[model samples]
Target: MKEKGFRYSILASGSSGNSFYLETGEKKILVDAGLSGKKISQLLAEIDRQPEDLDAIFITHEHSDHIQGVGVLARKYQLDVYANQKTWQVIDQQNLIGKLALEQKHVFECGKLMTLGDLDIESFAVSHDAVAPQFYRFIKDDKSFVMLTDTGYVSDRMSDLLANADGYLIESNHDVDILRAGSYPWATKQRILSDKGHLSNEDGADSMLRTMGQKTKRIYLGHLSKENNIKELAHMTMTNHLLKADIGVGQEVKIYDTSPDNATPLVTI
Candidate 1:
């Protein structure tokens, strides 16, 4: 049965910065703050929210792309930042001021479910180059969503975390062939293909097929590389593979690619 009241939306989604707002029970939590504080404020205003409305900020990693605006937002909003020790270390390296430094932040290991207001937030390790990149699975009422991005490989544990999600925000970075032939240097290409690197489009689709359930409602393809992949190709590849698996793409799932430069219309769940 669906929860009587629960809502979520992506404030912004793309390679530059990622942020999402989840309203569970009576709490408003932001999953990340990678975009500029000014931009975040504008986006939140569009959704009828202010920075003060956020209860906390949950960080998935310390990559520059994910934490670029953390420093400014934290100081301005005084938001509680949640992350693990390793992630904190990387953030500290950025030398962000005030609340973004992670010194007075709350640190928690991945793989445990924690409650914030009425929401159940679970964090799990992901295969990325960052000190401790993590993925999130959020449950509110009876609805749940799994956000799996930035990782090069999907382990059994990650698969388990995603197995029962109602929606998925999965990374479909580069098309392997396109990446292989692109202008990026060989070393950079090798880095992206490593186990602890970014996930390619095929890898994302493969992971989705492995973890999807009948309850899966939508797939939001995210974190696409601007250099070597196109949104249409990612969509078509995933669609074809899902068909071969006896899964009618739109029958049980609706797949949408994230905007490479801006936010897609808020996906309410």
Candidate 2:
């Protein structure tokens, strides 16, 4: 059965910035705040939410695109900010987000489950070129949602932990061919294609196949590359691959596209 008032939305996604919103009837939280505080607030307003309504902000890593607005929002709203210790170190060393009050800082260990209001949340390590990068799984009642992104490859443990999720916001970052032949510097290209880089469309599809199960239905393709991927190509790549495996794209699972410039409609789970 679906949990009432349980919903998730991608506030913004892509190489430029990323943020996600998740809510239960009693609580609201943000997964990241990469955009400026003003921009994030505007996006929240589009979804009939405000920064002050959020209970916490979770950090995936110290990458600027994943943490630009974190300190600003945390200070302005007095929201708790959670990150693994290593990630916090880099953020502090670089002053990436700015000053965060001691009271607003919360450190979490990967693979541990944390309870906040009506949600049970867990974070797991992912292979990425940042200090302690990770993704999250959120559970409410019997429904589960996985926010899996910013990883070049899915680890065996990640697949095990992510299995049978009801909804997924997974990375479909680039197309291999386009990224290989594009105008990016050779070093940049190599990094993106490396095991610790971002996932290509094909890799993303394969990872989804490995993790999705009977209860999986909703999929949102996120963190697309502005240069190496287009929404249609990423969507079609996953759809065609699923079809080959006898999984009906529209019938068995509904796929949604996220944007770097706007927010996706809040989807109930």
Among the numbered candidates, top TM-score falls to 2
lDDT of 2 by residue, 122-159 (tens): 99999999979978999887889999999989977789
Scored against the true structure, residue 44 in model 1 reaches a CA lDDT of 79
For model 1, what is the error of residue 241's alpha carbon versus the real structure, in angstroms, after optimal superposition? Answer: 1.3
Which candidate has the top score in lDDT?
A: 2
TM-scores of all candidate predictions against the true structure: 0.92, 0.97
Query: To one decimal, what is the Cα RMSD in angstroms of model 1 from the true structure?
Result: 2.3
Question: Candidate 2 at 197: error in angstroms?
Answer: 0.1
